[model samples]
Target: MSSPSSTLGGSKHAIKLTQGLVALFAFSCGAIVANLYYAQPITELISPSLHMSAGSAGLIVSLTQIGYALGLFFIVPLGDLLENRKLMITTALVSIASLAAASLAHSPGWFLAISLLIGFSSVAVQILIPLAAHLAPDHARGRIVGTIMSGLLLGILLSRPLSSLVADHFGWRFVFAAAAVLMALVTTVLALTIPRRQPEHQATYFELIGSLLHLVRTMPVLRHRALYQGLVFASFSLFWTAVPIELTRHYGLSQSAIALFALVGAIGATSAPVAGRLADAGHSVRATLVALSAATLAYTPALVHPAFGVYGLVVTGIVLDFAAQMNMVLGQREIYALHAASRGRLNALYMTSIFVGGALGSALASPLYERGGWTLVAGAALVFPLIACVHYWFVGRPHAHGRT
Candidate 1:
């Protein structure tokens, strides 16, 4: 492994990633990304506290996702044009402020605005992932990405339970306050350890943003991976958004019980590194199929027994999380291999589509649950991954084994 100080500001240095650095990158990604999900299991608590209507409560999650999508389009691409370490640290500071503000927000509108900021700043993780790719050798890039992504997926999976547990005991406001402190610690650690990389791209910010359209127009792999992941992510968002309501309303589970249920879902995060290894070993196409099929089929246990209790939903959560996360890592591995110089922009385009899908899913959750209940929500979720599977079957080719 190359020392961190050995490869500053020049692409000519051979960048060999160390395990300690990978762990730091993984931990930072996990801690930062956790900010987006802390509200998922506590929306019911937040709605009443802020006088938000039950119908519009989904906005808490959707607005955050919308902000994340906006940031992906406007901010993450700067990784190619700026000093990455400074940019990430600046973004982390903004996230800390947003999380702090969210805790103090008394009005629905105020809290919603803060939610958007939290999501916007959380795109630092996207920038960091590409940086990891830049540091890794070609042979180990997928595995390294997968290992770091495992931390990210763990953050996503664990945030729900952590927030639920916190909210149940100390109110939802405390959740954000605690998250602010955690973000501060993560930012300080990352600033101290993460190496600086000055991007060689010399374009102005406008040109960098403008080039996104051209990249989208030309990169079939980017479009295909984005489309597939977006559909599956929508399903992921829908199931998680509605399941909290289902558990609370029908099963009479308390916030802590819901927390426990969410913890079970964390088991699915183990698939991320496994998927990464598969992608590295020339099995991405088969893995993609497995991921899509697993996502579509994950809803079966719940659909077959809508009233069969939390165990069935637990099964659904684990399988869906496993499938969605696997597909995510697979997509990242492929896109990161596309154009080394354009990775930041490619990731920006790819992640923007995903959050758009997630925002739509979250926006639909309340209305779907209110009108048609779990059956309708589960049915809608099923259709998303199933559509991806159909599209992959007819349109996707087996050439994923080769580098694009």
Candidate 2:
């Protein structure tokens, strides 16, 4: 593949996006983002081994997300000031070390600390995404973001099953070890192939960080889109974190069966690119409605899992994944459009809110599941997206038409 023209600094010309480069970005994104999720399905295995109480097992997933949110807020914005490829590589290296440490962790405290670092370093995926947005031309931005997001979503959907399968045979620690190896390869490939982008925005790191609040205060679209996606993503996180428990305890599925169940959820990832095309075609408002509505209804089937069996939970997972991912891509396209030079910070704010919500959901998973079972978990999940739908109906629709 041809290399991108040297050192894009405030250029009006967008880099020509090659298929090879797109594939590389997608693969790297999938590999990097997968780190945040590898622990989700295996919390049960890890918790007992690390001497964590059943009631606190959800902390495993929640702390990772909390770390990711922290990175999104504090680290991802550096993508605007630092050289993009180098920033990504350096971050990935941190991730590799964290994963390696996680593999060897002997105590719950030690593992939890490493989990936070894993999530923090995994912010490289966030950096890579905005970089992709920077490189793409305006007309194709949504489609390109959508396509790359497909990889990220696939990583999220696939990681659970892949981790479960690996852990089932090789033990949970092996999952992190293998992830570190995969990340090492991905980091090397991205460093060699991905083109460089240097942002024109000139500000002290402190000022750059401070501007995040200003951006949130000034950009109504950014705030709205973030709120919408955050609510839905909370629902998404809650389901995935708690569902494995439900499948195992309620349905008596083995880890291998849970792996297959997660693989079925991978089907929902197909919506990412479709959502992107919709955003590009000026149908974002309508598509947003559909996504939110689908999310609201996704939990209904899972609430009656005893009557419908695992198949009902399967349906819920697929629909919820589809809705959440569709909404995510759509939100990214919207936020990325808001400012070119500050795509990093915009994405930082947007995704920070998303993972914060995700952290909350994951934190609540164990307690809710233990207290009231799937019925309560499903009820809470239903409420998240339903709240977003209500806000959109009363507030968002009137202004959405203003966008082309």
For all candidates, the clash counts are 0, 0
**Residue pairs with backbone atoms closer than 3 Å in model 2 (clashes):** none
Clashing pairs in 1: none
Report, for every candidate in turn, its global Cα lDDT versus the true structure.
0.89, 0.88
TM-scores of all candidate predictions against the true structure = 0.96, 0.96
Candidate 1 off by > 4 Å: 1-15, 402-404
Q: Across residues 277-361, which tens digit of lDDT does each residue of candidate 2 receive?
A: 9998999899999999999999877565568878898999999999999999999888887767778899999999999999988
